[model samples]
Target: MIYVITIAIYLIGLVIIGFFKAKQIKTQSDFSVAGRALTPWVLVGTMLATWMGTGSILGNAGKTYQTGMAGLWLPLGSVLGIIILTQIAGKVRSYNKFTVPEIIGERYGQVARLLSVIALVLAYMVIVSYQYNAGGAVLHTIFTDDSGVSAISVETGTIIAAVFIILYTMLAGLLSVVYTDVANGIIILISFMIAIPIFLVEAGGFDGMQIAFSEMGKPEHMRFFGVYSFIDIINFCLPGFLLIMGDANMYQRFFC
Candidate 1:
């Protein structure tokens, strides 16, 4: 009940913010770049929320729970990609394009732009599907019956999430998204800060975790490489590294 109420309030807040921002968005530039007047902190907040999605909170965390430190390889790719992006970030922003394909169209051709659009559409579909799945899982968990059966079906929850996202996006474009992301980034950071110490304490600290893993006959979980091979690490890293390098969302943020 608490979870449902909290989520409901959050959703309501987002709607209100979207409507408020919509009034300010009178032009294409205002919608796309928030009038090019966002603060550095706002950009930082949006970037953080943009990068850390369900893939980080749910997928990577689940991997770490099951296979331990090996999961670090997944994010390492993104971290390295970000490091490289910093070098060209200034140039990207200076280009003053609304989208990645727009920039590609200028330098390359209509053919490259079309190809990029197709590729990005396919990639974003996959990304959005997982986000919907994660949102559904959260709703299902929170809306369970006394017997532990979910009151809300995953499909219903997924549709709800999809509607909310679509409505939010259509409301005010990047203006609302950046503000919402700033709030989300702060919440996520605070959540981690509060949860980590409690998690360590509940698990009886690092030594206790080591002992527990040892007793479970999976002491390798504590090792730097966990149970992953060199090939496994490379496989885990490459996709994220490559994705972040060409991520249209990141480029859009830069354009903003």
Candidate 2:
């Protein structure tokens, strides 16, 4: 009940924030690009929050749980992409376009711009679908009673998440997202710092963890790329690589 209350308050808070921020959205630039006024830290925070989602938390964790060191492909791909992104970030910002499609139209032509927009819409739909699903999973897990009864079904929780995110994004757009992401960024940093040590300890330290892995008859799971073929490795890494490189959200942040 307490956990439910806390989450309810958090969602309500976002609604309140969105309500206030909506008043400030006087133009397309303000709504979509945040009026190009974000400083480095705010931009960084929004970029981090936008990029780091269930894929970073539940998705990556599940991969690591199943594949051990091989799971790193997801994050390692993103890190490599980010290293490359640092170079492109400045150039992207200079374009000062409202969206990635604008850049595509400038660099290529209308057909390319149309294709890019189509690609982004498809990618964004997947991202948002999973996000809503992840939110539902969170709620379903948290709402399970002591008797193992689920107070909220995953579907119901998903609807709740969908409504909240849709309303929030619709109400205020990028301005609200950036400001909220600032706090989310800080909280996530602290969560990772605290959770890592606890997880390591619970797994019985690094050496114990290795022994447990060996006992699973999957010692290769500890190796780089493990038993995966070169093609398999590339396949695993490509989705993340392509997604990060093409994400319009990051482009919007840089433009800001």
Candidate 3:
């Protein structure tokens, strides 16, 4: 009942926010680029929140669980991406493009734009599918019940989340997404902060965590740069860094 109530409240809040923002959306331009009027902080918040979704949360958690500290390098890569992006912020802002493909097409030509669109669509669809799957998993865990309704409950919860996201996004575009993302980021940060201390207390504190880690025989897990050679870091960073150098999302944010 508590779980249901919590989810109901969250859904209601999201719907309310969407409805309120819906009035602000007047055209495709407003939806797609938020009238290109986003401030720097809003742009940064949205980019960070969007980038740190299910793929970052669940995927990184699983990886950290399996490989210990070494798994953290993936998120560290994103920090580097942000730093690289800062250097080119001026250029990106100047481009004033909607999609990455548009920017690429303008810079490289029609063929580049066509290829970028194909790639972007595939990437975004896969991301959306994964978010759906993750939401279902979270709902199932939250509303665990042995009655055969767990599956149905989880699926229903997932569908509800998907519908909300689709409707909110469809109604207002990037403006709504960016504003909601800022709120979402704050919520996630606060929730994690509160949960972590509670979790630590429940798990028996720092000594308990140490004992647990020792029993798991993973002392090296605490080191962020452990086991990564210079060449390895370079190899992992090179392509991604280079790609962001020309990323369309970066350009769009700049234009806005």
Residue-wise lDDT of candidate 2 within 109-184, one digit each (tens)?
9999999889889988888898999999999999999998899999999999999888888998999889878877
Candidate 1 Cα deviation (angstroms), residue 238: 0.5
Estimated TM-score for each candidate: 0.97, 0.93, 0.83
Model 2 worst lDDT run, 10 consecutive residues: 220-229
TM-score of 2: 0.93
Give one digit per residue, the lDDT tens place, for model 1 in 182-203: 9889999999999999989988
Model 3 alpha-carbon drift over 4 Å, by segment: 146-157, 200-207, 220-251
> What's the C-alpha lDDT at position 40 in model 3?
73
Whole-model lDDT values for every prediction: 0.87, 0.86, 0.74
Per TM-score, the best of the predicted structures is: 1
Determine the backbone clash count of candidate 3: 2
Q: Which 10 residues in a row give candidate 1 its minimum summed lDDT?
A: 220-229
Best-fitting candidate, measured by lDDT? 1
User: Which pairs clash in the backbone of model 1?
Assistant: none
Q: What's the C-alpha lDDT at position 138 in model 3?
A: 82
